[model samples]
Target: MSGLVVHSARKVDADGLVDDFWFVADDGVIIATGTGIGWHAAAQGPGRDVVDAGGHWLTPGFIDLHCHGGGGHPFDDGPEEMLEALATHRAHGTTRSLVSHVANPLASLRESLSIVADLVAVDPLILGSHLEGPFLAPSRRGAHDGAFLRDPGPEMVEELIGAARGTMRVATIAPELPNALESIGVLIEAGVVVSVGHTDADYDQAARAFEVGARMLGHAFNAMNGIHHRAPGPIIAAFENPDVTLELIVDGLHVHPKVAKLAFTAAPGRVALVTDAMAAAGAHDGDYRLGGLNVTVRDGLAVLSGTSTIAGSTLTQDVALRNAVTLVGLDPVHAVAALTHTPAHALGEDHRLGRLHAGYAADAVILDHDWTVRRVFADGVPSADPHCTPARFRMRYSFCQAGLFAYAYR
Candidate 1:
């Protein structure tokens, strides 16, 4: 790839935000960064490709650890659909993401994991798979299928982990379930991030899960119990644990602006702003399905059929950033960190994925003053490939059948 010199932009770095800064990158890695008066002159050398941002905001590419689908495609299907779903997110400034799959049958979940593993090999931006179900509380199952919920047995966890081939970045489970603490230990040992979610786990049970290595509170305060004056609930338990990272969906519907602000103050830098979006995220409000569960999207909020329970969100990282700053009243630097650095750390990729530093992956998003995506670069090059399409095909072919009949028949 040719050297890229980005000029005339405000740069948000790991330390803080800077103005009148310039960046130089090659082979998808940041090579140099400088600020102030003569930076524009220094960036005008020959043989260097330049991107004049025209005074846009330049920050590290957004990293989303939990997202289902977007652009009318869901991740519960296959690679074609997964890539399609991811493209919509990329256009919205999510440069890297873990394809989050809802609870499904064991066979389907395994197939999705294998498909995501293959995609990761070809696409560096496809970080991995996050199994968000099949081991959650029935009462707070959210959009997951209640029939598929189960205890996290060692054998079952091993099977899912094996399918991921070490690409299983996170597994959300209820700490109150049988063998849940033990499963947390097993998942942690296998390099999987254990998150406590969709549970009725009180403070004591939640604390024990954290002790056993659960490091995340998935969508804190949504699928779990509320904070009682006396009980304190799982959210409080998670906040007290310094090792834990809290995933907060900053969309005004999933979480109130004040609640989101409280999370930032309570957890500080430990909060990760995730989309937790479903298929209708980048699409218009309409009917959609999540993991075979019927959902209705109205006024940009998704709700399960016949219930007030929120299915997922239609939020994007850009909106999450905007809400953090405009609604939640957080500093742009801390808000950016929640969307970038904090989420990267939660996925155990802080060393590479987050921040605009040398040696980090050349994944970044350029946003206008309104925080809309103007340009996105992945792996040191603009993703101008037309094949980077959204997942819209709702085929019924399973991966096993697709491998047998589709390839063979073709």
Candidate 2:
């Protein structure tokens, strides 16, 4: 009979926007949602706690489809470090995440995947593991170690799949690799959502991967071919595929604001905002490691130790949401959808993970009218205040077709 009910709020989800919204959840699943004072009757049971949103921005908790680590702990380190990283993102309203692993030795990757599988078995918040390397193109390896770079050979793919033990939800493969077209089919057959990235694939080559069931484009415009008049490349191929989702990192360091806005216009509901964060995310900037490579994070920009090669990121989903509205000129409702529903769809988990409808998870991120995360509720349990503070918190306003967008930094 115990339940958590939130009433009188501005809610945005699959239904777009609903003012004076209310939803009641019991045993970690939403049982009903309505408008005005409708939640009163549903929340009459014992052990009920009601909160007045007062018309603040309330949306579903973010789902990070691609994230390495945070809170000064790398997902590749071990189970404890992975849990710590999970905690860090959860505080920032990422209720669910996939453990992303960079290129590493097969043994190391297997161990990490095993650890992730163990955690996913017990933690519903852990979506599963994502293989971002070992099957990548060496020429566009970005921040991954080159030594472990290899083609998506069937034997290697089978081994990693075995290591993940049914917990492998997503992987990025370069379409230009030998046997990659067939590998994409194999991965899809194994229930893994395949993405084409870290590739030197041309437009046709990328199209071939999608033809074989590649459902996502990994961190579009980063570590992949750019849009050339003659060579449209994988990004264009992804844009053409209606079923594909494009992952974007809008931390201001990885992409230009204008280009990011183009993604929204081109793909609409298909763009998923992923942090692609390393350990420095939600933690102090300094030295960190992604696999065996040394990374230096200064001013929130993470790069390789001795070169200008961009590393992962120091971004959380909340900051990405704000940047989407303010910097990228996206509607607040659309931006929230990218953080919640789109990513969940990418993993085929939207049935229960995304949206604020009945039978969905009781996870919600309550934000102030200014779009700042005031609190987060996951599994019917509330969180402490969001530990999200970027280096600068200036209020910058940008007028676009989406109206006046406000940013936390200039």
Candidate 3:
């Protein structure tokens, strides 16, 4: 339970950026935070680990609500491959991540969910599993396996829910499919966040999904209908609903920068910047597989082989943050909040995992002037080395199995 203090930097969080702030964490929990000379006394304390951030940018560790894999390893592979991907993103300041899985057969998906559940039990930073799969629409299934896309039946839905064992944090569904709305109700009943995506759903249908408890739009504007002025698809529908959080892939490929800025303006605090990144992220441009689909990455853009469909992205959170500011013209504080608080709020982990305040988890990232990650602290332990090792914390964030939403689900 050693004490650690980071000071003399620009701190950004829900309170916006503050100059020359300091915070002290004991064990794995933030105990105190202040500004200016208050930290000088702590710096001289015995058994204290003090880091002078040197006026660098400091913010809460990035949280990826939707990410498949990175470092030449897909999450669908297994534990070893998933760990490899986690390590790769961890170095880039993504301290918390939901291991996303592409569409696969029902049996295969259940097995993968079990693997992720086991990992969540051991690794505090692995923030459970997000099933972006089999319950999607065939016509809008971008890189997902079309063969496995099927209607969500009560029995099938219960099986998948049972397989996850309370670790299934998110499930994506196309409201146009048969029983999809009912399935959304079931997932919400099970305390899992339902997202609308990979659908041919029009405005009314998308609106209906959100009204029924679907609170997220997965990588909006890609793999779904775009705004047609008259049509006003899911993007517009999501913009109208205050309860919804729109996931934007700020890689500037899946979504244009101008349109991305529009989302930021329209939704305000609801845009969650996600890296729908595949195995090729943080790796070389080469051939990769997303679920059962083959992908080719060239010029850092991944697309289906011999086709124009963007399979996924080769992006990490650090690059996404920079793109939000430089390419999309968003304020740096808003961009950082999109990476931190917005995603954490989307998954209902905003209670502790997102902000850099007292009583929050000791997780943060230190970025140099160019916004590249210079160091990461997970559970109050410094990951100063480029190589990342898994951290174990006492009060780690996890799926909401405690029924905190008992009234909402009731």
Candidate 4:
């Protein structure tokens, strides 16, 4: 009888948008749902709190499978810094995240993983740690420190798995490296979601890796081969695989809008929109360090100090969703799914966290009419002040069709 009930909202989930929807949450799980005044019946209890959404948009909380850092703190720094960064993203609708660390020495990587594991024990929002790591191809090492790149050795894999202490949710590896396939098997066997990334792997090699339990392709078309008339690369390999999820950094800087549209059109529900973000995310653009590599942020784009090699982004999940809708020409429902269920499914958390349904986790984001985050809740607890007025960004509709789409859904 004690719970939180939200009413008078436009609900979006994997199924699509529902008008005048309401849901109730108790003990961190959704317990009931309906449309209209039925929520009034549950609103009378002593321990129940009612949230009048006032015709706002409510969707399941966002899940970011690949995120390095945000709010001027890198995940590799320490537990406090990592938490500080997670707070920033949480305000922008990322309710749960896999803390991603770039390539570092084995000892440093292990230390970071251990710290994240400890945090995971204390914070339900900290899903686990993601190692975008030492097991990368040197040529494809984007923002990762070059000196720390190495082949995925079995001993190193075992050490990392131990360091994470059952909290390693995902690990990125170069599938073409020697012993890489063996390492993929090792990590997958240990319950890690193996991701093919930072690699020179061709179509065949990438397909083989996917066949052997590598379920994710990291940041499509960046730091990897491109699709050509004759050379269909890892992106195509991922597209062809029925079970693979392709991660797209839809910040408009990482991949072109047309190409991103192609990814959405080709992959459909399989595209997981990720913020391969760094320390500069949710912070002012300036000098920063990513995985021990010097990065300069100019015009909101992060790159190696003096090179054109694009580094990680400063994007938050809300902005990525905006780009998916306004820039990449995706339906709002599919864009929300890319941020919610697709990534949650990537980490095998769809059973609880991805949808606004009975028996699901009580995580949600209330967005304004233009898709700006108005409020966020993790486990039914509000993460940011509801009174904080969100800054509105003007949407450029060059690629978007002219229409009154929001009211049409209702």
lDDT of every model, 2 decimals: 0.84, 0.88, 0.87, 0.87
Candidate 4: tens digits of C-alpha lDDT, residues 351-380: 888999999989999898888988787888
Clashes of each: 3, 0, 0, 0
Q: Give each model a TM-score.
A: 0.92, 0.93, 0.93, 0.93
Per residue, candidate 1 scores C-alpha lDDT tens digits across 1-410 of 76677777887745698887777887788877777554455456666677887888988889898899988878887676676688788877888999998999999999999888866765678889999999999999989999988888988999999999889999999989998888888899999999999999999999989988899999988999989999899999988998899999999888889988888888889999999999998888888889989999889989998878899999889889888889999998998999889988887789987888778887777888877778877777764222244333212223454353121100
Cα lDDT, model 3, residue 81: 77
Clashing pairs in 1: 28-380, 84-390, 84-391
Candidate 3 runs further than 4 Å off: 384-410
Q: What is candidate 2's local distance difference test score? A: 0.88
Candidate 1 global lDDT: 0.84
Q: Which stretches of candidate 2 lie over 4 Å from their true place?
A: 388-410
Query: What value does the lDDT take at residue 64 in candidate 1?
Result: 90
Q: How big is the positional error of residue 308 in model 4, measured in Å on the Cα after superposition?
A: 1.5
Which residue pairs in candidate 3 collide?
none
Find the 10 residues in a row with the least total lDDT in model 2: 389-398
